[model samples]
Target: MTVSPAPREHDVLTDLLTQVGYRNEKAFAELYRRTSARLFGLCMRMMGDPDDAEETLQECFVVVWHRAPLFDPRLAGAMTWLMAIARNKAIDRLRQRPRTQGARDIDWDALPDTSPGPAEDGENDLAYRRLSDCLGALENRQRYCVRDAFFSGLTYVELAERMQVPLGTMKSWIRRALQQLRACMTP
Candidate 1:
């Protein structure tokens, strides 16, 4: 007896995205439910203010709804495409902000310390450096695939097509690269 493999998360997201492209409200709702928190976190990191992040997240969904029909799974994965939209929206918001010529004279002690403490910031910096090193250790193709998939927002199918490799092979390369990174990151 043959047992079928469980659907991967990207595959489920891909299906939901396709349904959303058909203007299915239920699919859009489900997609929002599944991805909003992740996208919100991304927005928060980019915008650096809760209010701005909230606004950016709202704008992102609006664009997502209007552009869902343009999503092509062959070109990018659902999450990748969604993230690209969110990133672009955040950038647009940033660009619209009025530039200040000089730092305003303000009492620094009056403001609350919303940012991370020095120790925490150091840890975060160290983690980033470690991750960069781990990525650099990957095979050239695997590194390229991972960067394209997560940074450039390319889908596995798109990566495969661009790299002239089978989809499964591209997936395997990324999976193994991630595994290696995980191992390297562990203390």
Candidate 2:
């Protein structure tokens, strides 16, 4: 099962972020305590290697520390915004290397060890379950493609080649898949 790192009740995180923006070390430490594992798992999945994931996670927080003052809650909730930074960091790390044909097909056999595993019932878990259900509604190819692309940071062209489809076809598939996800995710 897939899971996210942080929960969405981010009003407190927003307040903490405001403090971090002003260079409050305690708030930053608290932020890390709440979200680090989740972000580490995200980075691990994207990088597909534990070491790289750790590095990316650290870099993500460093950026967060510096950029907290620039955060705008009007744009997204705190965890959402923070995870975006983590995602971007992971993607950047992935893009730094040439795409290897071998890297395209990650073993989908089991969940990665780095993940926090199943979560307890709560807002984050509820949101997690909702996303899982939406993903479950997807066709196998669409579901796999979307998950693979996001987790692996593969470009559409790379995913197309890996899936043995044309680039446009892959793009269309992912786009439609994302649209379905949006519809499913809407409350």
Candidate 3:
């Protein structure tokens, strides 16, 4: 009679992975054999395309191979981390497209300015009002760093440049800002 390996076998595989270099295609293939079908199904459902899903599956496995060393068993289940990586890869592939800019320039006034309706504007304005009010409660420098990072999408380097502050100072300010924001937002 044939005997199957216990669930502990998979746990042993994960533990061994950190020590085994990523060059071990056999180990990678073993992991893939276990997980690919579920990941492929998830990709197909999210992307609605079989070919793209297959491509994403391959890309996800590539990342898994490279990042195996970084995986932490204590933080989350192995399957959860693997699935999250697969989902992110599939989403990235689905969203990737060429950005085309036409060379011909037309008069700006000729274009229809279909701005957001008054209702949407009012909703956005109210949300901004609430955010600004909450932000006003923060220390002045903390608020500035938070606003620049959140609203302007500026990185620490960019914020440091704009604020004429050191990068480490900007990082510290933003870190403190986020801690305070979370505290304020929480009950």
Mind giving the per-residue lDDT tens digits that candidate 1 earns over 141-171? 8887776565434568767887899999999
lDDT of 1 at 26: 97
Q: Quick one: best TM-score, which candidate?
A: 2
> What TM-score, computed on C-alpha atoms, does each candidate reach?
0.55, 0.78, 0.46
Best by lDDT: 2
Clashes of 3: 0
Ten consecutive residues with minimal summed lDDT in candidate 1? 100-109
Q: How far is candidate 2 from the true structure (C-alpha RMSD, Å)?
A: 6.3
**Lowest lDDT 10-residue stretch of candidate 3:** 99-108
lDDT: which is higher, 1 or 3?
Answer: 1
Clashes of each: 0, 1, 0
Q: Write the per-residue lDDT of candidate 2 for residues 11-124, one digit (tens) a residue.
A: 667888889999999999988887788888778767778998999999999999999999998877677788889998988888887655245466654774544322222235
Clashing pairs in model 3, backbone N/Cα/C closer than 3 A: none
Candidate 2 vs candidate 3: the lDDT winner is 2
lDDT for each residue of candidate 3 in 39-118, tens digit (9 for 90 to 100): 77666655556897899889998888888878887775455577678878865764463223211222222434343332
